[model samples]
Target: MFVKYCTTLFAGIWLLFIADIAHAQQPLPDKIAANKAKDWQTYRQASIADSKMAVYFRALTSSELEAINSAKSNGQSKANSKLIEIKSELTVESSIAGFLLFLQDYDKIPNWLDNANGSQLIEQITPSHNIFRIQFSAIWPVSPREMLIESRYWQDRQGNVHIKVEDASDHYTSHKNHIAISIIKAHWLIEPLPNDKLYIQYRVIANANGKMPSWLANKVALRSSWRTLKNINQQLPNSDWQYQKLANILEYQELIQEPTSGTNEQTKDIMPSNNAELN
Candidate 1:
């Protein structure tokens, strides 16, 4: 035959390209231990503002203060006082599965997420839940904006992890020339301190609904949540996202069974011992 059919069609395309690179390097089955376990509450012990950022208050239930004084006496909406909950705290050395795989990598989130020009991952509702989208880059005379969040992360039983973002923009479908961040509430606690530290806490609140002004949307959400939590704690001590190898993240399975005594420590810990003071 034609050279044995071209060597069996190049050995079946080289065994399907090594089985698609072993199914893209496997290891993504953690559905938060069958979900159900969120009741996260705690944000009333302020004092984190040596420029580290804070002002994430909560407490409004008299029918939400009579629907924000009946929408400020029917002027309609100020978008709930421009909803601006900002928060930040730190203590790094990262490893809660390398900062939750650098916050589940949504296309590497515009590299470091400062103004986040773009990001995507429309849906993956499992390996710890997902449904994302991000875009934002207009800062003068305010305009460009986007968000379709619906994140979810979990892991408790002492070894904390949280995550939890909202506002799914009615489950997808967006983008008609930006502008659509009606409201979004966010959170992301990591906590797992003691030696190989990691105690960061982040918070957010949004409402760039349209006529942006609540003191310029809380001064651009407090300098963009303090430079996006100081650029995710200075990019989590980049050792390629600090050894990104998540397998149900038990501290990366004990740092891959003690990688030579956690390799000389230091992943940028200490320096944000309570930082959120802007009420």
Candidate 2:
């Protein structure tokens, strides 16, 4: 349900080709300022100056790179250049049967968020789809945020479940006491292994939608990724969680509507310029 906006890990980062793209274009102020770039519009779309991304990327441990590469479904897209996509998975000491319930209990998601006020279903599109909302409190220098999300759950024949969520702009508006975010893309992959355990992969690519220093953006992205995985590792098993029985999930998979956005891509253009629109 994405209470993630409040989590300390998430507050700082999102899809960021803003990496070298940001640094390469804008030189770090000789005197590091406490504020964002003087010109985010230009910083968002400018030619490379030095490619600080390579250095930052090289700083990553080999394992991190391996995971990021695994998430790429095919050749890179515009998103891969300016955004940072994270892929992480953990083994849950539970059966697929036990885990499906954990996913269904979306209301409890607030317990998993960092500083989220709460989470709940705004509307259920079908057995497999829903419009959900999360409210975030002020996270320091940034304003509090509210997000209306479109999330879909699908269970395949093998019993694996795929949950996808993204920022949705149909009925929600910024006037609702929170900054309305425009881009928040992430997916949860749950695969049931044979030995009474589950393998979970949570991959995310996002654009925080406002503005902040690129350095801050990168730091936030890395920390949030690690923290999110750690929390899920602990949260799922500890909750007195149980699956809610409904129509067979197999049926849910077949009957669910196609992704409401009508797109199955993760990297087609995550970050656009000020005048650009998200595709």
Candidate 3:
């Protein structure tokens, strides 16, 4: 009786160990599908907001002459002069799903971005809400050491994600010698595309605190936006490859349990190699 009990106990332990290994290797299909759906929705809203903002900005530009004339007649000398110095604004559009995938996998801002030296996560208030601090330095001439920036992300009632970035420190002096001199506002609309793709559009309105030249500031903003998109383009293909590999593994596991000839060998031969191909 003791020998029989020992055999049964050993068999039970062996079965449990095999079950754990199988569970670890399996991907949660339901979770992955839900995540992809959520990402698609985020990108869709961003696209609509981007279109509206573009029309509004263009109208503002066309009315610039009237604005300048009104300021001059009102004895607003400073405002009148500033109107002529206004630089062209920058805009960037991308796939929302791709950007989110890039962010989730690559959290380090400076790694994929150019002219971004120091970056750190400041706080995590909740799963969806987090604060990030970043420092940007000049690429050419290397004038200032760095510009300190703090950013926050939150979701609105419509399930849209909004991100805001602001200057956090007063290392450099503004006209009033106050920290309020350096403030920037940016908005992003993230949407999803068919076939696991995303659509992301970004709009930025910056108030440079009279320290940086308007033209130079605009260039910096444009460069930063391009760098972010370039990084996403580079990172997305790798993600697709990973997903395909997981799917293949799941298919193989299901097929092995069925009675089949050596047909599986032929299928394996036709499988494509996992190469890093970016679109």
Candidate 4:
């Protein structure tokens, strides 16, 4: 009874923090404000105070919050198995082609992603769709985790790139020592912004699929996400991403047609829309 009470208390505090973060955004620009008022009522601003950029998270159900507090009791259920959703944005100085090129280098993924033990390309199902496996290292008492992910990427007519990442653990046999994560739905939105900057938005919903405590898993998820963004911001400029290229993408085709064409000038008036619409 005491353990349950403590869990409930901690969860209450966590939700309060979520509520605080949701309302902590600096003033939004007109377009973003309009989108927030219209399509993003369920999302709360989760970014740091006074920052122009904002991150958002959806409110979790009571069962979902319970699952996070104690995985053994609630996480095994089919309904409340998923982790909390995280949506974040990063503005970085990189061309669409360069960023795509950086992503295509699969082996280097662990360098930027926190807690990643190994990242490898399993098979190239298609030029844009491929299967990869990632190993995640956890602290003592929690078994290490592994995921087989199917990544599919494409570009829109508006010159924005979208990558969908999903769990594909059933494709291969599971390892003996690693806990296989069974659910993952993640997306990456790389939009071309004005002044040669790219507005990158990433959203992920996953489940640990193991006996690890939910609170610890949630903590790791949030911190790793923020760290990943920071790493991307720091590492993108260090490489010559502009000179790098992938021939399969539409942006690369457009570049072939007009080598001198600059950034997506039409997207200047465009702000990111609610990511829920992508589903």
Candidate 5:
């Protein structure tokens, strides 16, 4: 009787252990993956909307200045020069579609964008292309005023979306210092990832033709870029349900392929997403 009891007890323990392992290795649910994909799509749309607003503003500002110049040439009267002193100093891009979503309402630009005081959509050129004009107010030490910015967006044959921005402040006269600056060029590329996420990459090469100091220029570039990224990260979640699910599956797969206990060097080498291996 004692021998039979011991065998039953050990069998029960073994079954429990197997059940726990199976539970840990279970795959993620389908609903979680769908939700995560939807969220990523929203993020990307927002980014595209912001770029469109920038492009539209740039063109409008340029046209207004041209009209002023044409009037002056025809002996209308010298226009105000102080308007030219204010500069548009910030450019931003995001992989999340949230930017475009905000644009649909047209009143939320100032809320999400750091320095934008006001914005308006001038035209809808196409389903993929749009034009928007934005007026940004200086934060401080820089005069508080609005400068026009224009932006354009289109996808290439490779399905890569590209955004181009133009600054139209050059056409107007600056009453403050007769200085003018224009956006030489800007680009934003969105790369889609697994589970509908996107990797956003942005690059801008701008020229300041005004008599501004080099130190100030560098400061603006660094501060603006850092602030934009910080804002995006704060707004977006790092790990949604789908991300957590994927991580769990990956960890389980790793364990199954090399089930070992203790400070095993071999296990460390096979670990996924290990930074040590790259180093």
Candidate 6:
């Protein structure tokens, strides 16, 4: 009971922080304010209206298709900037619970996290949200980049998990001799389907800080997203992770529900919705 209270308190405080961040930019025009309010309301109702989540993923898929329909490359973008948006989709042949477990188990994520240096947990914040120190190793001359980030996951009323992981280096010393990413926002939409299938859509918008060409950055971003998606597709169902079972699912659910256990890892939660509007 004590743990539950603390968990609720932390969650509530973080929600307020998120709200402050949302309205931080003042002088909002009336129309923009109205739209923001409408969007907030829609998100609040997302628990019950998971169709919004479904539509969101579908829209992203459609946007990717636009280039193909117009006879252009899928990831071709004329806007040359430091920031890039890369996305990929995958269908995990497992139950919703199993798919989520695969994500939450950060220590074991490298089993399918594509070709990368590695990822280590700084703190397991509420199973759904946690801090991770990751190494992004590229070819030589580029050196290796290390960063600390916080990933938070939330579930809709339909039992789908939406994830948002952002750079949290403000609290840690930046790694030297490597280009640190100044801005990175990764969003994931994991929805449950019939027959225990799970649909996942992952989108990443990032700025690889330092002197890097826009074309190269764009290529790396797109390739990384696609590679990760492909890895998950080929690895998760065939994985030997025990969390794939119903018993393990229930055990994990219990852990999330435990107030004391939550207290051990509770931290300021910065949800993805705080940074980007999903719909």
What's the TM for model 1?
0.28
What is the C-alpha local distance difference test score of each model? 0.58, 0.49, 0.38, 0.63, 0.38, 0.51
Tens-place lDDT digits, model 1, residues 86-195: 56676656678777777778778776777778888887857777888899887555678888888666554344667777777765666876776744456788777656
Return the TM-score for candidate 6, rounded to 2 decimals: 0.58
TM-score of each: 0.28, 0.56, 0.43, 0.66, 0.43, 0.58
**How much is the lDDT of residue 115 in candidate 4?**
78
Q: Tens-digit lDDT track for model 4 on 191-266?
A: 8766667788988767676776555565566666666776777787666777665654445345345434453443
Residue 144 in model 4: lDDT: 88
- lDDT string for model 2 (1-66, tens) is 456546745544533323523332334232332222222211122112211111111122244334
Model 2 lDDT-worst window of ten: 49-58
What is the per-residue lDDT of model 6 for residues 57-101, given as tens digits with 9 covering 90 to 100? 111223333432354222223222223344556655656566766
Q: Write the per-residue lDDT of candidate 5 for residues 101-142, one digit (tens) a residue.
A: 433334656644555666666665643345555555643334
Alpha-carbon RMSD to native, per candidate: 19.1, 15.7, 27.1, 10.0, 28.3, 19.7
Off by over 4 Å in 1: 1-87, 90-122, 132-147, 150-171, 174-179, 182-191, 195-198, 203-207, 214-216, 219-247, 252-257, 261-279
TM-score of 4: 0.66
Clashes of 6: 2
Name the weakest run of 10 consecutive residues (lDDT summed) in model 3: 38-47
Global lDDT of model 5: 0.38
- Stronger candidate by TM-score (2 vs 4): 4
Report lDDT (Cα) of residue 203, candidate 5.
52
lDDT tens per residue, model 3, 1-279: 999999998898767644542342212121122112222111111122222211111112324435434533221122211211111111223333334434433246667666566555555554333445445554333233333445444322222334444555443222222222233334555443344343455554444333454334433444444445555455444544334322111132234364555434423432324211200
How do the candidates rank by TM-score, highest first?
A: 4, 6, 2, 3, 5, 1
Q: Using TM-score as the measure, which candidate wins?
A: 4
